[model samples]
Structures are given as C-alpha cells and as structure tokens.
Target: MSLDYEEFNALFTQFERTAIHLEMRDSYGTAIELPHMAKWATGEPDDLAWLQDWCDLVREGTQAGKSFRRAHVIGEPLSDYQRWSHSIMQPHIDAGSEVRWVPRRLVSSIAFPGNDFWLFDDRLVVFHNYAGNGQIIDFVTSTEPADLRLCKAAFDAVWPLGIPHEQYKLD
Candidate 1:
C-alpha cells in the first residue's frame, strides 16, 4: 500500500535503531530543492530553507540513539545536481547521519532495486517511486523476507565501498 507523508514518517520514526537509505539516481529534479541547486551549479552559495524539516528529523533521530545512513551510487563525472546534493548533505552528516558515496560501477555484481529505498532495522523496507522530474509518486513499505533480504544485501555490498561524505571529493 502507498503511504502519505505523515503515515510514512510515523512508520519510519518508529524504527528502534537503524534507518538506511539507498539512492541510485544521479540527479533528482525536485522543485523544492531546485533553487539552491541552481545556485550551487553556478558556484554561488544559497541558503537552504527547504531542507529544514529533514534536518530537524535527522538531528532528533541521531540524538535519540538512532543511526541514519544513506548510500549514494553515483557515476563518474558527477551530475550538476549530484554535486549540489553532496554539498547540502553536510548538515545531515553533521547531524550524525552517515552519508556515503559509492561509485556505481563498483557494485555490478549485486542486483539493485529499480527505485530508491529506506530500510529500517533490517526488517521493513520503504521504496520510493519518483516521476521523471523527481516529484514523488508514492512510497510503498514491505516486510516480506525476500525484499528485506535483497535490500539488505544490496546495501551491505555497497556501504563499505563508499567514501564517507566528508571524504568524497567534489567533482
């Protein structure tokens, strides 16, 4: 079933220990993230008002003994949006979320999911469906053992190979 934002947040926030996200796209064209992204493309710094909610949540989650991790599988010659996204993720990292960059070609042996996902406590999985322009289409959560297995394997196969956000050189 598809979950609205409130329901999704409620479910995710309930994770007892770890929440892991796997992001495979090179660029996300979300409207709210565009302005700052645009400024970043031009080498001009822009204040990000849009990420406040997420920032707050990461902060709170980390404060309460939860581990928040995100792994980005990016190609060589990073996209403009990826560069911008990396710059913005520092605050999330500072808030104790572990953000890592996995160069895409390195994980060819593993079969990856078609969409991005959030895996909570190694049990539940939430897959994110996004339109071509990056508008969210829906979020589907599943606890099926097969899904958990695949997601967990894909994530584990990539996480250690990824460079931590602080060490990833800006392209």
Candidate 2:
C-alpha cells in the first residue's frame, strides 16, 4: 500500500539492479527532489573533480541501457534549466533511446487528473500531491499495464505536437 522513506529507497535501489522501466514527471524546483536525484542532476560539490567524476558515472549508467523516460509540461515553455536538462539527453536520443517530451496540458488531462502528479516506474506508482505541503503523500499501485498504456497514449498524442529542439529556438 505505502512505504516509508527508507522502504521507498530500498525498493528503488532494487529496481535499479533489475533494470526495470522507470518513468517520471516533475515540476521545476530545487526543493522537490529526492536527495540522490538532486545530487545527480543538479548538485554543487566541494570538489569540482569529484563532481565531474560523478557526472561521468551518471552518463555511463544512462548509456549502459537504463530505460529512463521523462516528460515536463510547464505553464509556459521550458525555462533555461529545463531546456538545459532536456538537452542533456540529446546523446541518448541520438543513439535511438526512449526519451520523450509531452505537452503538460495533455499529461495533466490524462495521468495527473485534478491535482497531484503520478510517477510510473514499471508498476510502482508514486502519486504526489502538488497542492499539499509538497510531499509525496501516496504510493498508489505497482506496474499496471493498463494505466501505464493509458498514460503512454496520452504522452504519444501530445508528443507529436511538440516542436523539435531546432524549432524551439525560433519560438
């Protein structure tokens, strides 16, 4: 039904070992990150060299066949950080990996109905309440194909409508 923070962490670590399909969506902010995600994605370090090494390891993991997919639908177009972060995945995309961009409205209409957003990793679903005090208040289901397919369909529909990166500059 639900797991505390330690349990959730262990489960995710296990998921990493098994190489399951991991999918997530989030709004842009510094406070909302899991400590590891924050450190890996946008962390400052005491030593620049160590930070670069960590970044290299992340890049290696990403290249070594991690099926990670994410979508961001901001109120407006992406901010500079969003753009940069999304751009960082270009090499993976070029290598024929599964990364995507879905319009936020379509995602809102489908997966995240009413309030809170959903994170679907194979079957483990985390429903986060955005309207609340910014905590991940619920862990709903695990690896439901029907629900995942529905969300994917919504993403597919919106993805085609997204302007390509080259065209983004023109906008």
Candidate 3:
C-alpha cells in the first residue's frame, strides 16, 4: 500500500529493531540510527571513519543474523559518487560483505518505473516520485527484500565497463 509523507517518515523513524534493505536511485539523504550507532548517507562526502563504524555495526548485526543491505545506482559520473560509495563500502568489502552497484538501465527495469526511486527497510518500502513542484509521493511496502542481489548482478555487469577508481587521476 502507499503511505503519505508524514506516515512514511514516522514508519522510518520507528524502524530500529529490524533488518532493512534499501534500493536508491538518483540522489537523496537518509539518517539511520541503530542502538549504539547512527549514520547519514547522501551524495555528499561524509567522514570515512564514521562510515567505517557503521560498517562494523552492520557486520556485527549480520553475525547475529540480522538482515541489512543497501544498493545504490550511480546516475552521474561525479567523483563524489565514487568517493562516497567506495568509502562507505570499503569496510564491508574488507570484511567480505556483499556490496552491490547497479547501473541505471538495470535498475529502471526492476524498479517501479518513476523518477525519485525507492527506499526499503524492514518497517516500510518507499517509492518516492516527484510531483513536479518539489513535492513527493511515497509508495511504501513492508515486504520488499531491498533486492540487493539483483542490484549486485547489475553492478557486476557494469563495473567492468567503467574505469577503476585507483586509475582515475582527476585534476
């Protein structure tokens, strides 16, 4: 079912005790807080250490069998995407967690077909669509898987086509 903006915000605010899966397109920001942790993910640059800390929390949660997944699509060729995504994801990769990146085409094929994209957690799944006047309509669901596997598949397919971050020397 669909939820209005306020209802969606309330549901997200109350979702601290369960696993969450997120499918994000375009760009946005989210503030996530767990028992002893809190984090912010956006298109902007965040402290690397802070992201590492969250990765650790997620790892601990995983060990105890808590489900958590985040899938992001790179819509721009901006360095910020690479930097932030890599920083937030490096720790998980180091610990052998499955982190995936999907391209726009694949994501569009699987998504609900709109502009603002989707966000899914254990409490609710939000389909955010722009109303053409800076307003948004959120379609929420409580049963979506966050679909990280499909996103991963798409990433695996696209990663090889892009330049490795290490080799990219931006002036």
Clashes of each: 0, 2, 0
Off by over 4 Å in 2: 9-12, 16-60, 77-121, 132-135, 163-171
lDDT of 3 by residue, 1-171 (tens): 777766754553344544333334443333332211223333444455545655676666666655454444555453343444554555765543445554455444453323333333323345555444334445544344554334334434444444333333333
Error of 1 at 140 (Å): 1.0
Checking candidate 2 for backbone clashes, the offending pairs are 123-142, 123-143
What is the C-alpha local distance difference test score of each model?
0.88, 0.44, 0.45
lDDT of 2 at 120: 37
Sort by lDDT, top down from the best: 1, 3, 2
As for TM-score, the candidate ahead, 1 or 2, is 1
Off by over 4 Å in 3: 1-20, 29-47, 76-79, 95-97, 113-171
Q: Please say which candidate is ahead in lDDT: 1 or 2.
A: 1
Best by lDDT: 1
Model 1 misplacement above 4 A: none
Superposed Cα deviation of residue 160, candidate 1 (Å): 0.7
TM-score of each: 0.92, 0.48, 0.44
TM match of model 3 to true structure: 0.44
